[model samples]
Target: MPASPSAKIRANVPIPLSEKAIATRFVSFSGLNDDKEHIAIIYGSPEQQEAPLIRIHSECLTGDVFGSQRCDCGEQLHEAQRIMSAEGGVLLYLRQEGRGIGLYNKLDAYALQDTGVDTYTANEMLGFAHDQRDFTPAIDMLKALGLKRIRLLSNNPHKADDLVKAGIEVTERVQTGVYVNQYNAEYLKAKVDQQDHSITLKQN
Candidate 1:
């Protein structure tokens, strides 16, 4: 078990919220050939090397940062943060943007999607997997944090499966919030239909 990670660590003092105050720590994974530098954000410290809440959030520039309603990424990210804030856990913000197809490639897929296509097929049309993301970075971060078990937070069943496959014990699976908007209703439905996401939306 790694007590301390070899990655660069920086402390963000006094991360204040409307209802609470917490400390945020950013751990930068070193020596990556990928153009994007990935990091792990620890919300609240866990008591010991035990199973804690973890959200392996892939980067979503449009939805997460810009609050785009084209998908539910922003809503899910915020919901995961709020939950982990109260319960205590780590959020591994992976740099696997656009499901590991890069940002511009994702943007191109978005254009294809606008042409009456779904999310999954759009990626295929671009010669990529439905989700090209790999959870190895997340597994490494958890191991570095001295955690072998986790209560994974996600609606995508494949996330937990991937963690388990990476030799981490998923003690519990927490379903993050689902935000259904006019712009992303079809997208959400397509996820449930094709991606096997466990999202419960109001049926029409």
Candidate 2:
């Protein structure tokens, strides 16, 4: 068996909170070289401490940053923040754009999408994996935060599996569903059919 990661190595710096309304702390690791990759801990109410919740959110610049509705990325991000603020948890915002294929390539993929290619097929055509994101860094971040277990909020079963494989005990799986729009309806279907993401179409 592979040696478990040392706790000391996992414990990095405690970044001071930036936002006043919602207390936030930033954390980083050398293992994740990308400067944009950051883990933000949003403190919950003073009473809820035992079994804090966590959401490993990969960055979606077009969505999270620019409010793009191409997919449900932005909505889910805002929803995660809202829920974490109420219940208390950490949001590990990874900089794995376009499922780890990077930004420029993602735009290329978008172009392919415009030509009738589904999201998965577009990535394949671009010589990329279905989902190139790795959850190891997230594990490291959670460990650094002194978290032994968490109630993970996500729609992807792979996220849960990756966390468990990395030795972070997942106590519960929280569902986060976003409304599907005409722009991303096919894209979302490809995620469900090809990637095994647990997202269903919302009935009107």
Candidate 3:
């Protein structure tokens, strides 16, 4: 008998969180590319009859890892963990860094943004799409976990829209909002004005 979870879940280990005091399970996928070996971390039970709360988080090394305030990635990540713990949810951490343009190029886009250019336009300036991320892998993970429907916790409507088009049902969209700071004021505004993310931040 396998000591760990089945092959689909490469390994299932308990993540003991001191602050929230919740039981967390980190489930690794079976067949993903080396560069995109994403993981699904769960809190509470995702197999409920009601749509489980979920967040499909793309890789944001700067924010998530280093706590960069340029974007709300880090804030959203923490909020997801907290909300999921209470609501019983799943958070899929996809490895599509820099909106699928990889990390180094993302820094180039960042430099362009420094020149007063918008986020999407900066990507176009560097010969990349505005938002090149694909949520299919996230959908694949959800299907593998037997979750056909979910209450998505995100501010990006595009995520929900695309997921529905791809056969997954997005029952409700719970906005993930965070405090705004001077460093990220413009960044947050652009997300609403340009990227169509559902949030209203005071423009400075």
Candidate 2 on 1-204: residue-level lDDT in tens? 232254223333444443533555455554443334455555543225666788888889999989887988999988887776665688888878899999999999999999998988889999998888777667766776678678888989999998888777888988897668878888888888887888877655
Clashes of each: 0, 0, 0
Evaluation by TM-score, superior candidate among 1 and 3: 3
> How many clashing pairs does model 1 include?
0
Ranking by TM-score: 3, 1, 2
Off by over 4 Å in 1: 1-19, 31-36, 47-49
Predicted structure 3, TM vs. truth: 0.89
Q: For model 3, give the 10-residue run with minimal summed lDDT.
A: 1-10
Predicted candidate 3 versus true structure: per-residue lDDT over 68-110, tens digit per residue: 9888889999898888777678999989888889899999989
The residue ranges of model 2 lying beyond 4 angstroms of the native Cα positions read 1-22, 31-36, 45-48, 202-204
Task: Return the clash pairs for model 3, or none.
Answer: none
lDDT of 1 by residue, 48-135 (tens): 5378888889999999999998999999888877877777778889888899999999999999999989988999999999888877
lDDT of each: 0.79, 0.75, 0.82
The clash tally of candidate 3 reads 0
